[model samples]
Target: MKHKVILVVLDGLNDGVARHAMGHLQAYAAAGRAALYTLTCELPALSRPLYECILTGVAPIDSGIVHNNVSRLSHQRSVFHYAREAGLSTAAAAYHWVSELYNRSPFVISRDRHTEAPDFPIQYGHFYWNDHYPDSHLFADAEHLRVKHSPDFLLVHPMNIDDAGHKHGLDSAQYRNSARSADILLADYLQGWLDAGYQVLVTADHGMNNDRSHNGLLEEERQVPLFVLGDAFSFNPDVEPRQTELCGTVCALLGVAHDKPVCRDLLRPAV
Candidate 1:
């Protein structure tokens, strides 16, 4: 059976430093409940470009969404589009940039903050406007969507880690604490989502650096972690996955047809 999927993108989370802070997620891996993989983000590791890359399997240069300020609708078809076209429900509790990418461009808070249109790529959305919008609140919003819509695919993207990184640098205590807090918050909903037959893929758009910035080639800026939960993933994955592989992986999880490149080895043969 094709399982429903929940993708949690923790913005600006560093693979190296965050591993030490995210003990709860580490424990889950240690206990054999999940598999951890490191994914290398594409060039110019900024959030918006990487977000589009992660969803459409197109690199920033190829898609022309090379920077965060490019604020326009995505031309490439995303997993949300693929899911909806395949007659599956899709929802997101994410940053407004997500809404801009999948639902509407230049998002208007009044008309676009809460949306439900079956024909839209993201059929249901609860988009937040603040960089400091609590991760706790974002997860709660995701849970609310799950309970209300039971969407076959859900995107939960939170920005607090990135916010902290931008304000205090990746090496600061605030950045570490933000990662720890997000891990604790995720622990609240993960098992329940898994029990409800949702395949969860938790990752980051990109990592952060000591200069309080990204969009560079530094290892600290390009490397992030992907945590695979539920039964869809292979503990012994045949090949490493990249950020661009996420779109097709998500479609594969939902049993939908898609043209994007996928990390086929990351999933079980039976899936």
Candidate 2:
């Protein structure tokens, strides 16, 4: 059977952070293909639009996702729609973003968004389900896969990094600490995939500026670090670090559509 592809979206993850620490990700890059490129979202490149671009391969204008808050519904089909509609099990470990859209899909694990801390559940590891969030759902799915019950596409996302970046400024220790946690969590997820014989892909919605601030149109806010953790993938990840090239590269890595990118593949191997 072909290996299922897992896409982990770490929001506001800069290329600098990924290059500087360079632990599990660097090793994974060495084995597989890694590319740092610009994942430029046209205008209003917030969470919903970014997710819209990622899932539909079209920018907000085309996908009808112009802002973070109002995205008109569509039956045109997306990764979530396709995977679930295809009889594949899909789970999202997302947080308080646009996670609600997956509720009606064929996805199994359900989660609800949480911005405040008191209501969130983490102690017993059992979260209220049938909700439509991503983080808790993804984490639990990974745990189940540890016992050989993984989903076809597991999407893990964390809000702490973006939360810290926006509230306390990107240069603060909060964002730095969140980055570290991202590394650690990524390591854990990849370990689970390796042990369970699954393929994994780690990337992000966009990059945050260490200098503080994300207006969404600038270069810093558009770039994202892309990495393929499994040994089955290979590429020259060290390319011209731009933000617009990520979508194509991601599609390529997933063996989806590498041929028709509005831009070129920034993650393509050096030949």
Candidate 3:
């Protein structure tokens, strides 16, 4: 059973930023198969719910996770849950959302030393340390978790760019610079993951514009990229033309079946 998946959710990342940082996502898209989808995210385009949706097969309406820190704790049966149910060593680190909300998740390289604490859960201030710091405690944790746990399902998140984009408009030089910085780090990590022959899934909750605003109703805000690399998945080489139908495309990439009950505006299978 060589089942393994890693989802990297680049928060507040827009199509423009993704294209600009093509050097980061391009290789994966070019050398392998990739798609883009127009998927709506939670209000304010925050990280919590979007990342949650990526984990659980449910939408905001179904997952009961609409706001940051609100109903996240209830999102217990995540993909990790499924993986663990299937008896795979599931693990997630870096993002407190991943470490805490999915407490039953198999492994975590978290600072949440109280993992053994009965009341332990994901805490934002402690996880992010607030104030948009440049340091990457999460990135380091991801590396540690991968090496130590070798989890079958891993989720890694880096937040400085999203933090900066939220503070300064997504189009601000500060945001793009932070985005590039993220790309640099991502390139190094992604390359190594591929070298190790691990299947990697790269995507975002939704697309954002420079003003750090999301239309949710428009393609500009909803359309985000998806890149699946390595030997674990398969997709058509003409994946580029199917970029906007992201939601279903991703399901296909990961071998999951899609069932959109409420978010009817979500992506559909490409014709």
Using TM-score, give the best candidate's number: 1
**Where is model 1 more than 4 Å wrong at Cα?**
none
TM-score of 1: 0.98
TM-score of 3: 0.73
- Give the alpha carbon lDDT tens digit for every residue of 132-157 in model 2: 23343456544653344355655666
Q: After superposition, how far is residue 108 of candidate 2 from its true place, in Å?
A: 16
TM-scores for all predictions: 0.98, 0.71, 0.73
- Predicted structure 2, TM vs. truth: 0.71
- Misplaced by over 4 Å in model 3 are 32-44, 69-72, 104-135, 213-218, 237-271
Best of the candidates, lDDT: 1
* Cα error of candidate 2 at position 91, Å: 1.3
The candidates, ranked best first by lDDT, are 1, 3, 2
Clashes of 2: 16
| Each model's lDDT | 0.91, 0.53, 0.55
